[model samples]
Target: MNKNIVLKAENINKYFRVPTLFHVLKDISFEIEKGEFVSIMGKSGCGKSTLLYILSTMDTDYNGALFLDGEDLSHKSADQLAFIRNQHIGFIFQFHYLLQEFTVLENVMLPAKKLGIKSLEEIEHDAIEKLRLLGIADQAKKLSMRISGGQKQRVAIARALINKPSIIMGDEPTGNLDSKNSEIVFSILKELSEEEKLSLLVVTHDIDFAKKTNRIIEMEDGRIIS
Candidate 1:
């Protein structure tokens, strides 16, 4: 396993046989290094999410060799992949996706709890710290539905980071936000990547935000373009 290259995918292909067969993703290849922020930009329906899903090991019924930290994950079963993903990767989606019924603190602690961290107090303390880092500590006791969208998304980021994953993947993270909120969201993303040495793969349509990453990969027709 290469210490620097956190993820690398070669010749990835995916298809769906629903309402007829659809070849959603063609052969694709890319590599992402540790602490590197890469933006995946493309038009709508261009298979960017398919690629992200594959990289994150969320969608595994595909053809490719996906290496994470120098280990090939293409052969791992769904359950095994889930374990690695919960510990090593975080995901932020366009929707905040925080459980509306749970308090921010509880939501953030969910992943750690699932990982069998027996010390609930310590885990809650850690979740509180992540909320503080995202400047939403005050909302920790509040339900996700009661907060602003931006705040909710911040909570989502905190939840994603609570496990201290080495990599964070965002799928159009700010697509649902207005300009100011989008800036705030991406700024947090940029800062977190630097401070935590996290490998970030953000899929976005915003050119300005996309260009801020260390590398920007443009996609067309399910293929990465230089």
Candidate 2:
């Protein structure tokens, strides 16, 4: 499905100014086909995270066009970008970012609620199924702060999939875990990408994990090196 182009980054460029100046992305471009698991590997300052942020719409001031299903993303306003993110993209980060105060079930439900998805029972049902798939359903009602790091990461994965996103982007998702746990997390991500036909883009410094992805992209000095 490479020809389908589920996502496209056309000559993308991003610059950060003030305090100091930096060209974070240098005419970078890439695409993720539907159901592909792609990994971006780079040194810490090579802009892999920055690229993911821009692609995920977490940062929108870049200089090129991003298309989702062939729709120009640069034309959208901040509110519209937020709405699109809510509707089609789910983000997972190294830090799990679960609200420590919220229960696992609550954390997963927050995004759906924010998007005004109706039928609370139905949403809960879906969320519960995700948690079950990730092996955390038994802890769904427990506070996130009380879970183990691996368990917390599982919660984060479940949260990311709760919306059934068309694309899920993760940055160093397994960076904080031990080898055993990292493999667990990657397997879950791999399962979801295949089982749900979701395009997954992950950035990682772990070469072993990166190599396991369907496509391994190497970056250096803000450019794709391989």
Candidate 3:
């Protein structure tokens, strides 16, 4: 494995037991290098999301191996996978999934707290710093519910970065935002991948967004088409 490769999937295959064991993925293999911004694009039910899940180490019932930063994670236990996900993989979803009742800062600090490597004050400081990096520091003290959709998404990004994971995996990260907001989110993600040397693996249906990434992995009928 290359030292720069943050994620690699080999000969991956998945099937649904229902409906007579329909296949959902076919010999998927790909690598995402450190600091690279990559996008996975396909229509609905094309298995892009399923592939993302496997890469994120959230789906363990696949037929192939997965490696993350030189570690073979294909057969890790559930507890081990949970720890790996929290410590190494960051996730951003189509919905921001912010805790509406919590302040933006608190929401961002949640993961760090769960990781329990830092004091509350240290976590708060880091959370504020992440928010500042996202240009949303001013909203830190505000309740998550009080912010606009775009601001909420930014908060989610801050939360994702709190652990400083090696890879950030996003499933339709900009799917719910307007064009203006989508562009804003996209730019932020790109900057993080470039300036911060963060790796990003995103699944999106937006061709425009996919086109702007460093590489676009296209899928069709559960197989890589390009």
TM-score (all chains, Cα) for each model:
0.95, 0.95, 0.98
Model 2 is weakest, by summed lDDT over 10 consecutive residues, at: 1-10
Tens digits of per-residue lDDT, candidate 1, 1-226, equal: 5689888888999898889988888888888888899999999988998888888998888987988888889999889999999988898999987888999899999999998754999899999999999999999898888999999889989989988887899998999999999999989988987877889999999998998888999888877777
Who wins the TM-score comparison?
Answer: 3
Tens-place lDDT digits, model 3, residues 52-106: 8888888898999999999999888999999889989998999999999999999
Local accuracy by lDDT, each model: 0.89, 0.88, 0.94
Query: Which sections of candidate 3 miss by over 4 Å?
Result: none
Clashing pairs in 1: 1-70
Tens-place lDDT per residue, model 2, 70-109, is 7789879999999889878888889999999999999998
Distance from true location, Cα of 121 in model 3, Å: 1.6
Question: For model 2, which pairs clash?
Answer: none
lDDT of 2 at 130: 90
